[model samples]
Target: MDKQIYDEMIENLYWAFPLLKTKLVKPFDKEEKEKENDLTGTHMTILFMVKEKGSICISEIGKHLGICKANLTPLVQKLIDKSYIERFVDDKDRRYTFIKLTSVGEDFLDNKRYKVQEFLKQKVSDLSEADLMTLSASVAGLREILMKIK
Candidate 1:
């Protein structure tokens, strides 16, 4: 890629990130209080991470989240206490421990995702048909381009 095109892409990405965060991410976190669990973003992130990996060892999760195991223990424990996740020793090794989301946890995440989708739908409901089409295509293109990175 030409340096000029690269620079423009970097700048566009920088601006795009905050726009998406404020429009999508922040609202989800804000609406979380509706459930009364009062879970923080970190808690939700860990839930999502476990969901993505199916099951993940505690130490690996800590490394991915850049949190120390000492501190991650309580967060994991909180999830366990809420029955949102379960911890078990790896049967073969008896050394590595892993956590996985429970059915309740999956339900909770699904509900939250539905709400966020509804919220975004409401926010865009008044857009002109042409603008909505444009936005949809833009997002599709953005995803296609970004997926090439890895």
Candidate 2:
């Protein structure tokens, strides 16, 4: 790729960042904020991680999330208070604290997932079928290109 072309692509990415965030992210953020629950985005991410991992240690969750244990503690505690998660000591080890989602946590995650899915579906409903296909193709091509990059 020509250096100038690559530079222009970088510039376009910078230009696109704010527009994409405003168009796609801000509305969702606003909607989520209006909900009765007060789970921050990071909290939701941790809940999903716990769901996917089945049960995970706080230390391990921190590692996966790039959060240090000190910062991770309060978030985990808040979830515990909400009954969204539970902490237990390992039966064999006894020293390790493992966290897992409560039924409430699972339901909470499901609700959030459905909302985002519906929101995205509604947002794209106005796009023509051909435009949708083009968007999908462009996204796939970009993914393939990124994978081939260092």
Candidate 3:
């Protein structure tokens, strides 16, 4: 892409960040409030990551989320306290610990998944088939480009 186009894209991204965050944060906050849960956005993100990846080590989770170990330690501890996840020592390597979702965590995730699906369906149902397809393709392309970065 040309420099001007690239600059414009970057500028647009900067402007879109807050709007995107607001779009995500509001629903999540509402859901949490409805459930009477105190989980923060970061905590919910960690749960979602674990749900997506199944079992993962703390270091791996931190790396995947672009967070450092020091920052993730307390977050993992909080999840453990909430009984949403469990940390177990690797049988073969005592030095490594793997984190996995507990049954409660899985249930929570299932509920969240349903809510998200329902929300998306309601929000996008009015779009034409072609528009939906274009949006899907655009999202896939964006994911590919993001994966290539860093």
Worst 10 residues of 2 by lDDT: 31-40
Ranking of models by lDDT? 1, 2, 3
lDDT of 3 by residue, 112-137 (tens): 77987887777679999999999789
Best by TM-score: 1
Please list the C-alpha lDDT of all candidates, in the order they appear: 0.90, 0.89, 0.85
Q: State every prediction's TM-score relative to the real structure.
A: 0.85, 0.81, 0.79
User: Candidate 3: where are CA atoms >4 Å away?
Assistant: 63-71, 126-130
In terms of lDDT, model 1 sits at 0.90
Task: Put the candidates in TM-score order, highest first.
Answer: 1, 2, 3
The residue ranges of model 1 lying beyond 4 angstroms of the native Cα positions read: 34-37, 144-150
TM-score of 3: 0.79
Candidate 1: minimum summed lDDT over ten consecutive residues — where? 28-37
RMSD of each: 2.1, 2.7, 2.5
lDDT score of residue 110 within candidate 2: 93
